[model samples]
Target: MSQDHSQDHSQDAGAALAEGRGRSAGARSSDQAPSLRPSLLDPLFAPARGLPGIGPKMAPMIERLLGTPERPARIIDLLFHLPQGGVARRLMGSISEAPPGEPVTVGVTVTGYRAPQAGPGKRPYRVLVEDPTGDITLVFFGMPAPRVEKMLPLGSHRYVTGRIDLWDGHRQMVHPSRIVDEAGFAALPAVEPVYGATEGLTSRAISKLAHAALDRLPVLPEWQDPAWLRQNGLPAFAEALRAEHKPDGPPPPVATDGTVPATPARRRLAYDELLASQLALALTRARSRRGPGRQNAGDGGLLGRIEAALPFALTGAQTRALGEIRADLGSDRRMLRLLQGDVGSGKTAVALLAMASAVEAGRQAALMAPTEILARQHHDRLTAMAGPLRLRLLTGRDRAAERRATLSDLAEGQVDIVVGTHALFQESVAFRDLGLAVVDEQHRFGVHQRLALGAKGQAVDILVMTATPIPRTLALTFFGDMDVSVLDEKPAGRRPIATRLVSTDRLDEVVAGLGRALQAGEQVYWICPLVAESEYVDLAAAEDRFADLQAEFGAVVGLIHGKMPGPEKDAAMERFAAGDTRILVATTVVEVGVDVAQATIMVIEHAERFGLAQLHQLRGRVGRGAKASTCLLLYRGPLGQVARARLEMMRETEDGFRIAEEDLRLRGEGEVLGTRQSGLAAFRLARLESDGDLLEVARDDARLVVERDPALRSERGRALRVLLYLFERDAAIRLLGAG
Candidate 1:
């Protein structure tokens, strides 16, 4: 499956450099040193010094918006800051034609003025104007009467525009939005672009800055295919940008424009961004292919042992995914694959199978989890499953002597499988013959961390797993570099969790149901939205709920919030798992990787406050065993339309992939990825919801381009490099060791 494309790349790079040298010589002879403009992508693009009117005071605000100080402001950033809406101005030659009771423009002559009652707290000036067809009043609440009179004296012709109403069947325009004379009217645009503003910023300021930045837009060669441009009826890049920044009216959907379909200018901008993304992914994929990988074929002995020890047989989907992983591990090419399965879909089992393969091959394998609890859970499960095969746990919480012994055994290749959190990647932990690295909850870790774990072995095969079933559109965009194995089927023995929606007002009823369930020897998870009640407002808190439930249910109710000490939290979880606690009141700390087969009832308080994926994950905590399960999504009264829809969607299906798509549609990509620090790409131009088709196109284009020119030595590729730098995907560039 591996190709030798690097040879072609090396030859092409040599030819490109030779041609560039000849051009450099010609430029020198012509007395031109060929502007070393840093490819318009140097770190300088981020320094506030490059932008006009961005003083020290404004720099901080820009930094706050961008969430970074290294990149301050740039001409391209401003151009990409798309407008949110547009304000269309109504134009009428005369007030006679202006429709009453609607926003209209009227040409009037100022005739008289009325001053507000002259007091400290009184309204200020009111000016009266009469047009040839009607009369209107302009009221300024704060302006001085003398100043207002001077500005619009008698017989002053002006075009006043605002909402007009009829009082006693007479046309009246209150608080005119614009008071423009003939000359001023000529300068006013019929339509104005309205941009989102921050605390100290105004839409006017944003428009001015955008205009200034647009002026600096360099006339570059078009990068899009001409055939695409003609067939799509898209304007040139510059024209599209101009239309977007100074839209005549509210910008139409991408379908109306024919180019990119999110926003007019943004869609064009997204195309460029997607091009850069694809280019970088292609380049990185190309470079990874260059790194020689070992074929670690393994005997089926250890795998058979682990599978035979399992209580249930593997589902068809799990078997298929495990087969895919085995095939990948046996291949000469490196195994950079993603294992995507729904929560409780037995992704961990698939990962275990893969790890067992490495172990059967006389090599070591390591599994990394995002959290200590998850790591410990994996360790416990793997230790039980790998008993016949022999595995070790190297978590941070392990005793010093035990950890030391485990490290020694790991270094000596005595440990078949090592399960831990990030402790596995620490310098102290060494694997004698590491063949595979399996990472759980892959999104929690960054690419660098993943790479560090992979680099632990001599080009180890990597199997990254995620319980969050990402929408296909986002999967291709984010995980395009890796082979994807989707576990779409749930195990046959798994029962559907009966989902119920309840209003928070019926808490007593829900609590009564929980009491009944607990009395019946069924375990319950009483999840809250927040860990603690805020002083400013009262909200259901996990601690408070634990206290309330403990009073009623006695010592059987346990609390496990993030704020608790690690040992205390682990104790609480242990109590719940061992059935010592019938009720576990907790926060989102148990959102992912916490598996309790006996917990059959889940009560999510203020479920509307949770995202669809989170709700799905919380619900997954139940229905693990054969017994029927129930999920009570207890939401507060008066849910917003979106929250209501989310609750309904959750109640309708247990399919994680469908829920994920709905979550994307409801919460958008930014919120879906969580806060800015999640290392998720916050695309300024591309909307994952709207531009999904473009994402698909970009992914395919990237794969195709890489197949054709792995090193980006082609002419089109040089231009694409500019795109990568522009979109901040330059991290992929460094993978080539080129820059």
Candidate 2:
């Protein structure tokens, strides 16, 4: 929205604007309400249904797009929903001067209306409108003639705004977006904001609601440092937000360079959101530090045994990571750290050593996985690696007798370490003295689950691990509350997989080549195209491919998919793990934490259908053992730009960190970490790709604010409290003791 457009809407909305927009003077007295939220934010936080022109029926539709189960859509949410772009309306005197496929606003008189034949399959209703220079047809499909006639009354001069296209060599417009009289046309801006539409809602309706929401903004005090705001040339909070909602002219949402215009308004608002997120994280970190940490780092007695038993030496990166994690464990402050390592970068060894450190201190440790298969895999790997400590496996699939015994052993301190799924956090399970908790694939379980596990013990140190290497920018946004440790080196004796791009046209040759791998007693993982959108389609694809491979390889081929029963899926995985089956045909269910040492060959069908990060993960499945590995990406011809780039990047480098950065550059933040899949709230205003620099500055600023005003008693500190609540970071506000 442009500034001119905002004024136009505000002019007519003055009559509807509330008399007391901000908080009353009486409400801000010394005896203010005990609520953490200030009274000034009431208007902005009001229910969207109360807005003008919004009916009860339309409220649910708005809520479906932006609401959560706990909270419905509010006026603030509508305000945050910014425009995608704008269409510039070029005022033309006549139709003859209108460019062929360009937006034009021309004054024309409605001459007549032409209705189509009454039938299911028929042409659109046409209206004849003309100027003195030339004439153009106005088309509306599936619209009643009466409505069309009423809208464009005959002999009425109106401004028609929309793109003019030469259809069948005749100048016509399928839909004239706006056909308003002179008075209505005068209110329309040259650049009209374009909004994304949802089911049962139109962009025009949303724009109206958003405009009404904007009128409720109150005068907010500046929360940012005065010197810093001047140094950055930033606008005030309300001014920046208003500028974003109302655009005036050049530099639309997307500029001609195919990049978002880093206008002053956008930069200011982006900084505001980044500041809120970073401040909340800083407060959370402060609270986490106030807890008494268990001094779990003991003399390297158990850790020495594991290191001595390993066949290969630890990488420099892994050694550095252990030093950092051990330092945190030794300090009195509670340890909340992230152990980030690329796929097969030896993170498990580091985790095992960290767990061993806790056990050496006579405290229990537990590793939680997201799935039962992963939990069991971790159990098997740890049992083989860990020779001395008593380790137990607990999962939802365990029999009642086995589960009861494991629980008894855990409570009695007989189990020194345990690996399981979310079952570890069940209320019935009690830990004698749990000193450390390591969560695998931290993106799958968010902060709530971490806190749930922490409740079982006293200040239990947490070290969440991710095989998907995250870029530094996203590291701040997702794991801002925790310290980070990255393992960048691959261990000794690990071989790089030779990646090859193959066309689907040579399917027969690829299958014949798999025969040699099978005959050599080498394990193979044959993956089908990613489940496009549904599981049923994914199941069929995997089964169909498994059938074809089974016919060729007799009984040695097995299939695994997410839809199969747990035991059945486990059986297929066990056969592949034990070398009973040489080839495993599967879907993306094997994407994460499924380790098979002998699986040397990975064949991904329709590789173009997968994202770069996913393709990298699948390739990591191989090259785990000392044997040389090969990854074949079978893609169809005429690949699109993004898909082609993904395959090329896969062939270019095996560095997961570099791949992660490229993934962020190619795609957005969502694909890099699977934000929606992980159930983590994404920043509604900040674009990580463009605003990463702001994140670093915001982080530093937040640290400074927390250090200076620990309780937020200062004037600027009080304003910052409103900033937190404005972004719905009220969870962090409650920690401030309701200033």
Highest lDDT: give the candidate number.
Answer: 2
Q: Which residue runs does candidate 2 get wrong by more than 4 Å?
A: 1-36, 56-71, 89-122, 125-139, 146-158, 163-174, 181-184, 199-201, 251-259, 503-506, 529-540, 636-638
Residues 1-739, candidate 2, lDDT per residue (tens digit)? 2211100011001011111212221113344433457878988877777888878789888877655554557788778877665666557867999877756788898998888976677679998999999899999986788898889998998888887998888889887867888788777765676666576676668778888888999888899888988898988988876666676773354643344667777788888888888887888777767767879888987799888997679999999999999998888888989999989899888999999999999999999999889999999889888989899999988999999999999999999999999999999899999999999987776456777787788889989999988889888877887789999998878898999999988999999999998888799998886423455553227777888999999899998888889899999999999999999999988988899989999999989877788889999999998799999999988898778988999999999999989888877776676654544345566778888899999989988999998777799888998887776566676666633
The all-Cα superposition gives candidate 2 an RMSD in Å to the true structure of: 7.0
Instruction: For candidate 1, write residues 579-652 as lDDT tens digits.
Output: 99889999988989898999999999999888898899999999998799999999887888889999999989
Cα shift from native, residue 537, model 1 (Å):
4.8
Clashing pairs in 2: 1-246, 1-247, 2-246, 2-247, 2-248, 3-247
What is the RMSD, in Å, between candidate 1 and the native fold over all Cα?
8.0
- Candidate 2 yields a Cα-based lDDT of 0.81
Highest TM-score model number: 2
Q: By TM-score, how accurate is candidate 1?
A: 0.84
